[model samples]
Target: MSHQPLIDGFEFATAGARQKGRWPVRELPRLRDMLASDAGEIAYELEGTRDERGRPGLRLSLQGTLELRCQRCLEPMPFEVGADEVLVLAASQAEIDAEPADAHAPDRVLAGKEMPVRDLIEDQLILELPYAPRHEGCAAGAGQRADERISPFAGLRGLMRGKH
Candidate 1:
């Protein structure tokens, strides 16, 4: 999967402006198949400018719908994901690390002097993924049922009881 170009050899100043546009998911590697299968669009708003050290920094806001499988039910689930991410584009990893810890971490490096929107989008999606993905209203019954099925005296409890 190749990265699609978003910002081409452009450096922003302190008073830089925000860039707003809709990027096709097909252009992004991770999102290509997901977007196609789910049949939806991913929209983004990029706000950034070049820092004093010449690093490109931006805050990206992404909102879109994705067709994904529910981790628990294994059924197709359509989820609307909204994420706000801050990224710093650095010429090298060392430069990125040199930045203050308080500053936002760089999701990617623009070493070659180009910022690919597709790459950024892929990163934002990954960062936005929930640690435990589940459909709404699907856990209350399932969790209680599992707990009920487990015997409180199934294993170690029997051994301890015998010793007593």
Candidate 2:
């Protein structure tokens, strides 16, 4: 917890400013629901830019480790998060809607006189999270218990083979 950074979107972009900071994981209330434990920190860097098309934008970079619950085993797993995102600032919601729809399009944010750096970072962080967070290799997963596993279809298999 610290002084929340706020900047004028247009002013920052026009001035080509840069800001960086670290936030404790627990402080991001929006992302708390998806986390296994609130015991880590995330570092972020935000830089203002003007695109070739004369559009004001912000580039955000985030790095940190998040503790997520493995969906299968419900065990805590460490997930490394490193993401870079570009957000094009639009004057209004209509301006954003006027743009052609494309899955590969950069995100657009409504330009505001006061934009919170913490909110911007958390928005991107939520998007970076997996739809179903799980460990690639969970110690409590099927692989480690395969020997003791028995299928419900085992009896059917024996009948098919005519074996008691």
Candidate 3:
């Protein structure tokens, strides 16, 4: 949560560094709005490593359960989050900007003197979240009590039965 920079991103990658920890989900201010309740901790591991093609990159792994609001039923539900990503380091923003767009290309982040750990984790989590969260077999009427349910056809059902 502190604004302090964790490490020089380029140096970390070059040195093959490793860092891991369990942080409270509430500490991530940027990710707060996405959660129904920020009541748990997220485990994260960030390592400097090389990709399959021998490209220097950072490997990030996150594991946690998030409390999210089900869009269908508007109820709170637990969603398990597990993500692993390799982010290729570009020498500079200009170099990254000149590259052609390709879906197969690994994600690129400009190497910098200062890279905040919290921001990196938050960015990945934001990208991984579903645009619309939902619980299985849940709908608009999902959590409603039977006594609170209303039917316009209630009166018509008795009328039709009498007519028959």
* Maximum-lDDT candidate: 2
Instruction: Give the Å shift of residue 87 in candidate 2.
Output: 0.5
At residue 32, candidate 2 shows an lDDT of 81
For model 3, give the 10-residue run with minimal summed lDDT: 155-164
lDDT of 3: 0.73
Model 3: which residue pairs collide? none
* Model 2 CA lDDT for position 138: 69
TM-score per candidate: 0.63, 0.81, 0.79
Candidate 3, residue 16: lDDT: 89
Which candidate gets the maximum TM-score versus the true structure? Answer: 2
Q: Kindly provide the TM-score of model 1 when superposed on the true structure, using C-alpha atoms.
A: 0.63
Residues 10-45 of candidate 3 have per-residue lDDT tens digits of 888878888888778999997888889999998898
lDDT of 1 by residue, 1-164 (tens): 12235564235313354666666655566655443254656888776655445666666789987766655776666767898754545555565445454313334344345656666667666545543445665653265233333344333321221221
Report lDDT (CA) for all predictions: 0.54, 0.75, 0.73
Q: How would you encode candidate 2's per-residue C-alpha lDDT over 111-138 as one tens digit per residue?
A: 8898888788887787677666656766
Per-prediction backbone clash count: 0, 0, 0
